[model samples]
Target: MENNLLNLRMTSKMLSRQAKRCQKEENKELEKLKKAISAGGTEEARIYASNAIRKKSERLNITKMASRVDAVASRVQTALTMQQVVRSMGITVVSMEKAAQSMNLEQISAVMDKFEQQFEDLDVQTGYMEGAIGGTTALDMPQDEVDMLIQRTADQDGLELNAELANIQAPQYLPDEAS
Candidate 1:
């Protein structure tokens, strides 16, 4: 459980780092587009600048991607908190299970088995998410590839879970001026 908490913290830090980098890139692109628009006064230059502006706008519309990432980060943070709570609950379960040793064997076994199954599911979810984001593994690939890999893994495990399943909830956007 301590290890899981540590990994969750590390994953959160990584996601924060990635989001910052994306924001920086987006800002740089926006600045370049603004400069081109302002300086390209000639007709020919204006045409080129118009193309650049269009491309930049397309990129900017990719704020959807950023928003998705932010939503996923928020969900991951929430999941980490829940995992910690579950770990604490697990301790209680362990104690109770120990005490229940004197009870009927079949009943205790069933309860313990259920808890074990839930823990396994939690662990698999963590592992799958970690791998998808290059968190714990060394798979330095593209986002599509990562998504495909995660999807394949999920399918293999009969999980049928959406690896790219990010909530579209509004995040508390940090303003550029604040920093």
Candidate 2:
């Protein structure tokens, strides 16, 4: 489980780096677009616009891939946890069966008498252990975070296009004032 999660994480990191490169290239293209627009070079602006759009698309795709990988890693963790629970339950059932077969009324009574205190002590001990060793690994990139990542990419896709285009209005019949 850990190995699978680690591999997915590494893949995600690589995708992230690729996405960052895409973003840098997109930013460069956008900057060039601004220069082209300023210089009244419509052809250059068109090329830069295409390149920027392409790069942004790549970044969005890479982000989505990373998010999916993270989701898989989370699910893998969940499955492993569920497996442990099932194993524990099986062991508990077996123990109960053995206890039922061997224990007399007096033995049962005595265990019942101590069960509450023992359970409480176990809880306290487990709590301290958890506090000492617990980590985000057990709850990494939950569904909500994956959803947020997807939502952000969706919002960013629209916002990037809208905001950049909005800022670049056509010359409003005035000469140099448009710049």
Candidate 3:
């Protein structure tokens, strides 16, 4: 199971790389499309557009395959862990059975009494209630407090992401914005 998990992870990584390469090729195809459009080559632009669309679908398919492989790997790992736990529990049960055979009836009765008394002495519910008495969760926040937090963080971010750079990619193909 461990080996199977490892193989699944490796396959997922390989597929992810394949997806990356597909995206790289798709970008190149899009660039060719822009150039073809700029040169007024209608047939060439159509071909490049078709190729770019195919590459995008290929990338998406590869990504989906990788996700499925990862999910399989996770299940295999969980099963392997459960198998180990069950094996350990079986050994523990055997040990307990052997020890039980050595204990006398009165000894077992005394142990059971002590266990019951200890359980009765522990106030688990009260301890938990005390811990949670003053606890506050996000859902407990008042509307006014939520509004204050939003206003406090309402300032514009200093970071700049110039998305216009994508349009200006083919400078010769696109007219200047100022013009």
Q: Residue 6 in candidate 3 has what lDDT?
A: 91
Segments in model 2 whose C-alpha atoms lie over 4 Å from true places: 104-179
lDDT of 2: 0.69
Candidate 1 lDDT over residue span 1-179, tens digit each: 44554565566566556656655665665666566667764564565556656655655444434444544554565476567759856875985677597687776777777777777777776666665555432334565555556555565687756434432222243233265
Error of 3 at 134 (Å): 32
TM-score of each: 0.37, 0.58, 0.58
lDDT of 2 at 23: 97
Show model 1 residue runs off by greater than 4 Å.
1-44, 47-95, 98-101, 131-179
Q: Ten residues in a row with the worst lDDT in model 3?
A: 166-175
- Model 3: CA > 4 A from native: 104-179
| CA shift of 128, model 3, Å | 24
lDDT scores of the candidates, listed in order: 0.58, 0.69, 0.67
Q: Write down the RMSD of all candidates, one decimal each.
A: 15.4, 12.3, 14.8
Model 2, residue 132: distance off in Å is 22
Relative to the unseen true structure, what is the C-alpha lDDT of residue 162 in candidate 2, on a scale of 0 to 100? 56
